[model samples]
Target: MSKILIVGAHGQTARIVIDRIISETDDSLVLFLRNSSRLNEYDNNSRVELIDGDVLNTDSLVSAMKNVDIVYSNVGGTDLAKQTASILEAMTKSNKKRLIFISSLGAYHEVPGKFGEWNEQAIAAYLPGFRESAKLIENSNTEYTMIRPAWMSNKDEIDYETTQKGEPFKGTEVSRKSIADFVMELLSDPTQHIDESIGLNKPNTDGDKPEWI
Candidate 1:
């Protein structure tokens, strides 16, 4: 069984991934979060190892990464690059190679139409850092898959499609569950799409702007 380490385990997307992992597989999970108190529900899960660690602290990250085979990061914030850089450094030091990262659609300026324009303007400061993090992963020697997902919703659906780096990002919004499903697939089969940066969106969502916006 694969020993998967999920950074930013308290995140909404990561929570869904954790639930799926618990239900669907016998793989072990290292759930890393800044606050261990946030994971009260997982206290009884034997397969889930809850650890408190800051992504910005290399020593903390290195400690959290011990015996981990794959690292799936669901981190997001204005300081995205710094966090990712730390994770990469720790991964390198620990000799852990496989990585799956979650990024934003606007990070690559891939969002299209009016929605894309709005997204760029909305998260102007944050997008650049995400882009930088993507670059950091792309330039690394680690086997990685960087996922850039469009505007996310809490909608209950798992229907989504993907576009590679150069392609125009399709649709306007994708559900968090859809993103979780995709991530789970990648974690289940790490060899697939080893070095690709993919843009994800719900199929048939073409519009001038996202429906929710």
Candidate 2:
């Protein structure tokens, strides 16, 4: 079984991915989080291991990288660029090649018009970390797949479509569960999305253009 490491494993999207992995596969998991107390919820599983550490600490990250085959980074913070740089540096030293990074949709400045205005507003509110972190990953040597999902909701549906580095998906929202499902799928098969960055969103089923257009 591939040994996978999940950074920020307690986050909403990470929780969904972890649950899916637990139910569907026998793969071993190492969950890295800032606090060990929060891990009580996932402690019963024998296949899961918990590590308490900050992603910005290269020593901690390097120690965690040992024997880890794949890494899914979900860390979020004000210093996103620096944190990602630390992780990338450690991964390079350890020679761990596969990475799945979660970024925000407007990181490429593709949102246009009024929707673009709204996107910029929202991005201004919450995208500095994702943008800088994604920049770090884009410049790294590790084989990586960066997924930027549109405004996330908590709906537990998997109905969604993907766009690759082109026009951003024209949706107002994408379910976090769907993003989790996509991450799980990527983990199961890394070859399909290697070195690619993509956008994801729910498809237009009501014959109306999504708000993000």
- Give TM per candidate: 0.97, 0.92
lDDT (0 to 1) per candidate? 0.90, 0.82
Candidate 2's clash total is 0
- Candidate 1 lDDT, tens digit per residue, 1-213? 888999999999999999999999999999989897899798898998999878899888899889988999988899999999999999889998999999989777888788888888878988988989988998888999999888899999899999999899999889999999999898788899999999999999988777877
Worst 10 residues of 2 by lDDT: 204-213
Candidate 2: C-alpha lDDT: 0.82
Q: List candidate 2 segments past 4 Å from native.
A: 205-213
- For residue 33, give model 2's deviation from the true position in Å: 0.6
| lDDT tens per residue, model 2, 45-109 | 89988999998889888898889889998877667777789889989988999999888778787
Task: Assess candidate 2 and give its TM-score to the true structure.
Answer: 0.92
